[model samples]
Target: MSNKKPILAITMGDPAGIGPEIAVKAFSDSAVYNLCRPLLIGSAAIMSRIVKELNSRLKVNSINNVTEAGFQFGEIDVFNLEIHNPEDIKYGQISSTAGDIAFRSVVKAIELAKNGEVDGTVTNPINKKAINNAGHHFSGHTEIYAHYTNTPKYAMLLADEKLKVIHVSTHVSLRKACDLVQKERILDVVQILNEGLKKLGINSPRIGVAGLNPHAGDEGLFGDEEIKEIIPAVKEANERGFIVEGPIPPDTLYALAAGGKFDGCVAMYHDQGHIPFKLMGFVWDDDIGKMKSVKGVNITLGLPIIRTSVDHGTAFEIAGKGIASPEALLYAINYAVKLYNN
Candidate 1:
């Protein structure tokens, strides 16, 4: 009742996916309501259907604006865009209607954050092909936020219980990702990660920079990227008084980082970071054919507005099964709240 907590605008990702269901599940947790005021930015009709389908005790309060949100548990305040009729969406299938609604919800959340109407934004997963089919051509959530916020320098920071990894180049081809590894870009990501760690309550972060090649280029035998680009970047970061160490072999760096060796890590590409992080955080239940716990928060660093998202993609295979874990979304919302408070 203090009215001091941040108000978060939670976007409904691809309507055909588990976005709506997870939003419902995440809000059902009373902890989320106690920490921050949540405003769901998507179709009220879709959420209403999802609530009924899930047989949840919660109800949806369709509001026209942020000011109308009640911020109450058992009643979700939706900033209804009304972009899709629940009848138009088919579970486990991608359609242009779902894509359009997903895109619109994200754009609206960004606008609210930029205008100071909300403290931060929490996004669920959106299918890339679906959004492209709807004519909004963007690779993923990070790219969309970067373009809309006009943020030139941004890195995707993925964090779970102990491991944290930031990417230098994401949503690009392997060839292009290699070409993107430069000293300046590496340094930039390290700087962003350092600042991000401080926000996460690390007083002094020891950062690790991963090498692009195996065995850190075998001392320039396998490749010279470490000596040419990575070493210089690490040297500069160290000289700048950042507790940084790097040019470590990617094969072993993540293992050490996960064991509490480093505060965070910087990777050369998307999969380099994601593969290891997901391996650690994601748990699949083969018997149920769904995730038991999707446990990572994808935070966009260097953005003017705070934005965090579920690290996992839209689980289209089990969209309406009522079993898609909302753990990742809960983590994302909590992270957004943490960053906003920071």
Candidate 2:
């Protein structure tokens, strides 16, 4: 029993997506094993196909239990879910079968983490439509984590080297997103963000809250959300001893945070935070018409078990191309280890 390495369960998101590819690429990097013992929880057949497709030299050691895994440095350890065949594993396609398999893998990972079978679970990307098509009815990973862990309060934290963002409402429409920003919800998210940063080793995290409307409603000209809900939330959070500042203009807050002025920012909606985070983390090469680097980790805070995932999605178009970037998955696994250590 090597106590130096934390046991991490990595789930292959959807066979139809780039999940298998990135999971293989992430573990193939020898540096990953140095931080934690990673055990992939997905189908062996799918992984085998991916290994051959990518021409990766690493071998897959299939196991039924976490303890059964070899945890070898160069070899990839997979807990075979045995859900799909190679013939059924078509890339860039959406099917209920794939959805069911992806959902089940996540469920199994959650069960293992809750039971302490693994220290944490880091997930690859999964399409919400696919998961819903399989009758799982999940909006995204955060909701799945919340349901399985029975956690009432949780926030989606997107992190990179320069900036960290926690969203108040995600996977909701822009109109509904604004409506959901009440004082209580704002305060709850703020508290979660503060606590999450502390766990990430920040002793005193300086948090900036983004406004809900354009120019923060221009002092009630654009919208009243900032004045009514956002400001009150910041005020209440401060009263509770949280080092919080906000209702700042959404467009400007992210830039300030990315510039290292603030430790993290609370985004009002999905795109408000996602765009800025991706702008900083994802690099594209226009001449090559491809992404040079895709970095960032999506962490669901307030769950009973630690859950981190790639901030990107299931790129069905490039699923089996062996070109998908594993940087995000690698970062997510590393972030999970950091959280576990903290």
Candidate 3:
């Protein structure tokens, strides 16, 4: 393996969303250059337009391959995909063309990582509706990554600072999500979380599993998922020599995890995991009527290749306004580097 700095392939998400804006802004930061060689895999025309729209002074160099990238300070190297028309790039509008481009960028990034052209990938937020409109038929980034890479046992891990969470099920309806929770799935997620935490430098990480029902089914009064599925999984994990806890109450597990009681928490479904993670990472300013800061990194575990992404989505309304926060992407990039190093 190469001992040099890890090369990260950043995919520019939906052209109509904040993906392009943030990509331009992220490379403008001098600190990003210091960590690793960042190469953008997206439309060069759209990126150039964003740089101009944002009034950024940084220069963007279009390259055909990773070796051709300059990786120099004050310069952004973009591998031109040429998938979008400069005139067709409209903010806050969804089009099949834009969706196809976004899907292609992700596919290319996975291909690069699988081929060892890059160490890992950090993806911008993609619009699910748009991607589906383009006939790609992916539910989200995790699904797409899993499909293209043929990874069968993948899970989504959300990280911000010390708090890390892995989900048992995501992108499914509430009814289906509840039914999908089982001992096998829960155990798989726990194992993935334990392995991931270790890679993040946590030795013998403590994992807390959240119950699927309200108030942990009140000990079978509210639901039996905790007793039937969650508890069994936790017991199995503990028997395997993992420091695992729970079938804990969902309401309080997040608080305990946030309080640093555990290294990571295993959530039952999408909202159960996303709500608490976002609440901690997203800071809303009521006076400004907007988010003050958006944080967190979404990592897809069990893939053949390493993939991390901004924990938020495409903010189409702020696509060209130059106000998009690149903090999440920065965090994702940093985490991707750490994962690569490990």
Candidate 4:
């Protein structure tokens, strides 16, 4: 793994969504080949269909194992998971079978990394309801990876260029998220984000922690979560010799981060981190009624094996149109390579 190309197990997210299409689009760039050998971990039949649907000339090379992948730029080496009649799961339609296929691919990717078969993993989007309908019962990929890898101290970190963010709690109700924001939880996420920043090449990272309440509790006028929960965490981090800042108003923290004022931000909850970060990454075009572009990469910090994903959703309305943006996937790959190198 030293001074050589790494092999990345790229899960072809739910076939019913734009995962397959965006993956194909990302690989078409060819420059990605110089970074790592990408092994597609999903249905070969579906990859072949996506290739044809996008009018791509690349051949789909179905393989039985990771070593079987040629990893050639002009060819897509699919670690083919033969699902039952994959053709039955049409594009843009949710099905339990599709969810099962997506879940299995991720499971295999984790195995490959744990067994030292691959360097890291880049995941595509999977539908939560579809996965639960398949009986997986996980909120999202972050939870799935944490469960499989036995990583209890994990946080979701979203990175787009210079703007990096981690949530104190994610995949929970807003009320629960508020209640969960104790000093211990904040400290845990702060530590995770600190390590994550270093892995991304930010030495001596300056971190900004967002307040759970408006205006960071407005000096206890809005809420006590900041005074009771957040400030103590920030104090502990400073005492621990980490460059930490905050109970900054959540509204203003992201703007300061976007302006390069801090190395990363600690979001108190999911939407607190996600809303502004997505605003930085996802651009909607009102005139066309579609996304003009999509950006940002989601990294699960505190896992033994590296996992990165596109920040966007399944985009069911535009699944097979061959128009979905692969920008985020490319960023995810770049970040995976960066983490794997470290």
Best by TM-score: 4
Candidate 2 residue-wise lDDT, 172-289, digit = tens: 9988987898999989988899889988989899999999888888999997889889999999999999988888998899889888888989998899989989988889999977
Which structure is stronger by TM-score: 1 or 4? 4
Error of 1 at 40 (Å): 0.4
Across 151-182, the per-residue lDDT of candidate 3 in tens digits comes to 89989999988679999999999999999999
Count of backbone clashes, every candidate in sequence: 0, 0, 0, 0
TM-score, candidate number 1: 0.97
Candidate 4 total steric clashes:
0
Q: What local distance difference test score does each model get?
A: 0.92, 0.88, 0.90, 0.91
Q: Kindly indicate the candidate among 1 and 2 with the higher lDDT.
A: 1
Q: How accurate is candidate 4 locally (lDDT)?
A: 0.91
Query: Model 4 — which ten-residue stretch has the worst lDDT?
Result: 1-10
Q: Which of the two, 3 or 4, has more TM-score?
A: 4
Task: Give one digit per residue, the lDDT tens place, for model 1 in 124-197.
Answer: 98989989999999999999999999999999999987999999999999999988999999999999999999
Q: Which of the predicted structures, 3 or 4, would earn the higher lDDT when compared with the native?
A: 4
Which ranking of candidates, highest lDDT first? 1, 4, 3, 2
| Candidate 4: residue 80 lDDT (0-100) | 88
Please tell me which model should have the higher lDDT, number 2 or number 3. Answer: 3
- Candidate 3 residues lying further than 4 Å off, grouped into runs, are 1-3
